[model samples]
Target: MADLRDVAMDSKAWPFQEARALAKRYEKAPPEKGHVLFETGYGPSGLPHIGTFGEVLRTTMIRRAFELISDIPTRLICFSDDLDGMRKVPDNVPDQAMLRENLQRPLTSVPDPFGEFESFGHHNNAMLRRFLDTFGFEYEFISATEFYASGRFDETLREAARKYDDVMKIMLASLREERQQTYSCFLPIHPETGRVLYVPMKEVNAEDGTITFDDEDGREWTLPVTGGHVKLQWKPDFGARWAALGVDFEMYGKDHSTNTPIYDGICEVLGGRAPHHFTYELFLDETGQKISKSKGNGLTIDEWLTYASTESLSYFMYQKPKTAKRLHFDVIPKAVDEYHQQIRGFKGQEPVQQLANPAWHIHGGQVPESDLVVPFSMLLNLASVAGAEDKATLWGFIRRYAPDATPKSHPGLDAAVGHAVRYYNDRVKPHKTYRMPDVSERAAMEEVLAALDEWQGEADAEALQNMLYAIGKEHRFDPLRHWFQALYEVLLGASEGPRFGGFIALYGIEETKALIVKALRGDLAHEEPIDI
Candidate 1:
């Protein structure tokens, strides 16, 4: 048996691959900061979305992988740029008038629309913390507002001031000619209005660590770069923040991939090595548009939790970090089923293979034994057929299928049952289109009904499936998917569904026969009726 550490070092899993590079950064000597730092940045201009959560989740996976390969200590930081000015009010939040009144002011200075925190920034930051806390993520939360006010960023701010011209050169090259005319590395907060000013700097006195800029009203004032009086523009801030904290590893979406050079340039200009970056692809909506927090266009963290387990969500995040995935309600059931499938397959895997398993990464190497005897998609089909309104309604069938399983003993399955019921009501029930089976499909289902009549002994899924296959073969269902498709459309009122045999075993032979009779009589309820 190979040592787990050796396996991790050689593992081709993405997290380990990333961790290997991060570990190699300190191969000869550990970080002088005494530990490796992993950071994920959050923009609090709006509520944190699933993508925001993905950054922290992915970073943590790499952090855990690093732990497996190295004995060095590690720390993870969830940094919030709460000091950023509110450029626009988020359409999803309430009290638009209040937010509009506070536009251009720092987020920490704006009034909270939800009235639940000290400021709008605090409200969103609390939302982010609550989200990370819900998953029990171990991270140190840092507020940019406090970091500056408390003088922790003073040295870095002063260094940026000293290297102002160098930072300007890097930023100026990235901007268009028009933007370059007015762009400055530092944004001054108006002393009277408390709004961040984007006006060009009149004077940058590095010796005094102050910048002089005329306000929108044309009044000239100079503010010290330290003590939260001024902030660097976003691009410059990205690198400056890394320098200030000595970040070793950070991962962001592909949208930020282009700005990597500028971030690194500014970080090195401020006398700090740029962190190793991993740029994962952005998530898209059902329409293939990018998911944005402000637009409220994609599935949210709470909405996902309403229908699936958190571990399933983590499992979705764990897969193909480099590839763009469609994050929608339709993807939830598949993620839940696949997550359980990974867990079920974990125990039989070799040490190397187990290390490569997503379940291992998701659970931090302590993968749990899955008790989901029935797949979630199967439960959804059962829910649709039975019109299951509650977990108890589904549990009746579940208890029959796995007689020894109880809610206490099989909590994952119980939770999945509840998820299936809710999912069926909200997603599956709304758009179900049932078609009157064509002559061929009708004959096939009729033959299925007759076969069920002759069916004897115990309800075995495989045996029943074989019987359905034989009947489909007799009915000439060329590809055989045609047979399953017909059953799913006629009986389940969906284009696709679980294996009919497994559904029958769980739903019971007598109940399945009744369901078939209803389908044969064209009595199955559907949201909309269509003819084929």
Candidate 2:
């Protein structure tokens, strides 16, 4: 354990790097709170999106890394800013007319369109909790509405009121001239209409812990900032929440990067130290547009889970967090296969390398051994060629290639087999385009067929790969990869595939020969011209 800790102190992995900085914060002494607080904030105006998962999962990774090098304990808080008003209705939810009526109301006051929870905020919070629970995340859920209403933030609210002008000076500089005139750090909720009023504050009485504001209806009211009568504006809330929680570390998307100073300044003004921040690049959709929670344009947590394992999603989250990544169906198979690949490689890696492996951080150091011998891409290709509608059909070939393995013995592989079949049918089958082999390609196919028929011993993948490599050279193909591409296009109806020899070994020698014969006969080719 001491040696592992020594290695972690010098590790270059991002989580360890972030954790080391946090550990340095308390080098002189422990925090007054006794344990460091790590926080990830969520706005509950919309359902929990993939961004929420990335933030929490990545924070947890750092927390796990911190435990390895430091003796101080840590707590993770998944804070939901549900008290914020719903400025606009989300397009993805049901019952739009009902939501339209609730604009400018705190999300907790808006009725749930799903009719399951007390309000829209509660519904979204429940969804977030459920999603986190699905991944076994250890976190304490805190609702802004509950925190404010229960007076847990009373001291911070009072502090903000006392430091109102100071907070305004920090915020006003960042806003446009037009917005600077009417903006106040406090937004008062209307006493009668139950709506959050956005009007300018006429007076901020710090001594009384209250603010004077006029509603849109032109009635003046004085409301205490405590007990949920008023809440801080979004920008102020960001820093105030940090101050109120004494958060040791927090992470947000790049969209919030510009506001870091405002949040930090406000925290300092309120007599609380600013937390360490890590801002990751936001995720993009297939077209490179930023993903939105309201627009629901990109993939969802449930959608990814339906096609792949949860660990693969975590693996995706762990990679190059500062770089923007396209979160779509195309990336899933690679994530799945690569995650298992890491697991397979863990046993052979040196201890330092293992500490740097993503699989270690993902599984919280107890990295599981991978039982999935067949790669996910290979399974998808096999599924495409076999027209597999069920796991049983894929298992038929899996049994032939690996005689002793079964669904019970290889649970990970079994789940991957099921995922492959679903991914192939839904994502692969619809767009598949097969074409006739050109004259030279047809000659290569006949040669491959004759070589398969003449083979006598067991189907050895390496030997077969060598034979195919020789075949590609014999055909005078400029790049040897073109021969493999021709084989994939003609036989699998896709431009990419697993290693041809490995595919043949898994699918059986006779089966591949039959497929080649079909391709040469134009039975597998579509009537349409190949688009190359």
Candidate 3:
């Protein structure tokens, strides 16, 4: 997808405007092809909080929107600052490093050793990836370890800081209040071994590719810069990193911003002017407490995918940034359905909003058509397939409707189609069938069944919704939902299925009636939930 700069002349709106202004001030004039913008977030060293996605998701969307409106390239850089030492205990981390002595430097951080991932850092970072990847987000993931060890940015860091000493000092001093170390400048410390991490200054004079970095501590021995780590302090090192890497945009939670007054000011100095943008706000819990990795109270992005799609997550990110709200997993499916419906309303997708400020337009505002998903096409096509009844019928429809949703030739296509079909059913025409044990529901359900039984040639969508709704109301059921569930259980031998009208329309009314009776008679428990 394109970056922000391509569309700087397009328009000045809330997000694009803010991004543009920063781009210009930084002297990073937006490009026609655009420059790469880096967006970063950390992996939860223990359990990841929604905040990880909260931060990255917004940045990703802006990048997408930018590409949408222009022709620039957009990229995200997620820095899992996992090398920093473990700070607090988590339920998952029984042996958390509690002592400040045990708390390694920010550049070398992590969780407990016996964690799920290979390293504590790896575990937490992986969780972050799970969340981002669930949404199919693309980013250049860099580890603090790899950044330091690789030495790709080593000369850059020394150069940026050395060249901009006065500005760097100003940024450092600005962070004094929230600043933890009284030492304005501190040396990088190894996370695992807890000692100064350094390269041989004695060897620096050589023009040849020669370098050495090791600590006196036993395990801190130097390895050939097969390049695995980056050695930089938190203060100016961070600023230097940003400047060196050309990170045009990234966001932090309000807590970090509220606590670290110098962030905006510091980023300004790093880029020689100001950052492209910063959107800040608090957190929201699905049911209660704020998400916390330390307390083991946070639900990770991986957890989110257990229920919702990436687009739904992206849509969640599209909501107002300043306001904090809980993302209950229960609403995700409906949100997806609604989002798909919204796409239909737009006749496709939301047009990309361009970056208005010429200065910071580093990339365009629209996602590549490849990355942009047409939710409506996916849903409607799946419906046609599921309605067609036979396997061949469904396959033909799926191949036509959501060509990219799945591969028709792939072995997994059926399962993928099944998922799409289920998504559609739950979202649009949710219905459940129940076994008629006692005659009242049985009689009414049968009456309703008989009505469909007696007559029904062509499927009328609106008419079916009304008819089923009327039957439920007349039978004193909770609208159509309750009875639908029962009907679903009876017909599909499950708690629910697609809307009755939609299902009947697809599979034929008579077939639905037969399935319902067969289910009530205990003949179809063997049936698995499937598109009607």
In candidate 1, how many Å is residue 340 off? Answer: 0.6
Per lDDT, what order, best first?
2, 1, 3
For model 1, residues 388-433, the per-residue Cα lDDT tens digits are 7888888888888999989999988888889998999999988886
**Which of the predicted structures, 2 or 3, would earn the higher lDDT when compared with the native?**
2
Error of 3 at 214 (Å): 21
User: What root-mean-square deviation over C-alphas does model 2 reach?
Assistant: 2.2
Question: Model 1 segments beyond 4 Å from truth?
Answer: 525-532
Candidate 2 lDDT over residue span 1-532, tens digit each: 9999999999999999999999989999999999999999999888889989999999999999999999999999999999999999998999999999999999999999999999999999999999999999999999999999998999999999998999999999999999999999899999998998888999999999999988898889999999999998998998999899898899999999999999999999998899998999999999999999899988899999989999999999999999999999999999998999899999899988998999999999999999898889999988988889899989999999899889999999999999999998899988989988999999888999999999989998888999999999999988988999998999999898888899999989998888887788887785432111
**Model 2 TM-score on a 0 to 1 scale:** 0.98
User: Where is the poorest 10-residue window by lDDT in model 1?
Assistant: 523-532
> What TM-score do all the candidates reach, one by one?
0.98, 0.98, 0.59
Best by lDDT: 2
lDDT of each: 0.91, 0.92, 0.52
Clashing pairs in 1: none
Please give, for residues 404-510, the per-residue lDDT of candidate 3 as tens digits.
64443443345334445554354433432334445556766677777787765555655776788888888888665777777655554345445566555545565
